[model samples]
Target: MGWLSTIIVGFIVGVLAKLLHPGNDKLGFIMTTLLGIAGAALAGFVGEALGWYAVGEAAGWIASTVFAIIILAVYTRVIRKR
Candidate 1:
């Protein structure tokens, strides 16, 4: 149940992040989902280190979405540079 919810949320977050990020980066749905999931995981670590949220606590929807977008942006930038 927990894993299911996480994947669903990550999918939604990934779609939202992809939409928010304006570019021509071609990525399939699966790739986008993976990116989103990775973004969420990264956000979790960042939030914990920055004291933005408690470790193991649920990240609010908006925060997670924004965090995912930030991650996506950085990812795209890095990919572009390479």
Candidate 2:
């Protein structure tokens, strides 16, 4: 996918992940987009390592969302402890 498409899909994935995860995560639009992109990248990396996906392939929605949620949890914890 192109950069623009990746950004668009990342935005949607971020929004979906925020909605699916309970609790208030007061994040702005830019932060959410960044989170989604990072999450997707993380998922893609792990999936590739596990032989679930090949290099240069985008991670699926479910995997992206799951990774995003995991990132969110980690972010919340770190922020809380700071």
Candidate 3:
């Protein structure tokens, strides 16, 4: 159940990130989901480091989406160079 929820949330976050980001990156469903998961993970670490929020907070969703966009940016850059 936890894993299922994570995937669903990741998909939502990834879609949001893709829609919100300025530039475009060619990504499949799995890749997009992965981007979201990675971004959320990154945001979790950053939030903890900066003391912006607590673990498992709903506020983390916004940060997660933002971080997903950032990751999307970097992913596009790297892919473009390849």
The better candidate by TM-score, 2 or 3, is 3
Clashing pairs in 1: none
RMSD (CA, Å), each prediction: 2.7, 2.3, 1.3
Return the candidate ranking by TM-score, descending: 3, 2, 1
lDDT by candidate, in order shown: 0.78, 0.85, 0.89
Candidate 1 vs candidate 2: which has greater TM-score?
Answer: 2
Model 2 Cα lDDT, one tens digit per residue, 1-82: 6999889878887898899888888999998998899888888888877888675555466788899999998998888898
User: Which residue window of length 10 is worst by lDDT in model 3?
Assistant: 19-28
Off by over 4 Å in 1: 45-59
Candidate 3 lDDT, 1-82, residue by residue in tens: 9888888888889999999998768889999999888878888889989999998898789999999999899888888999
Please count the clashing residue pairs in each candidate, in the order shown. 0, 0, 0
Which tens-of-lDDT digit does each residue in 1-82 have in candidate 1? 9888778878987898888889976878887888778777778777777888885566745566787788778877989999
| Steric clash pairs (candidate 3) | none
RMSD of model 3 against the true structure = 1.3
| True-vs-predicted CA distance for residue 68, candidate 2, Å | 0.4
Given candidate 2, what's the lDDT at residue 64?
Answer: 84
Candidate 3 regions with alpha-carbon error over 4 angstroms: none
| TM-scores of the models, in the order given | 0.72, 0.86, 0.88
* Model 2 TM-score (2 dp): 0.86
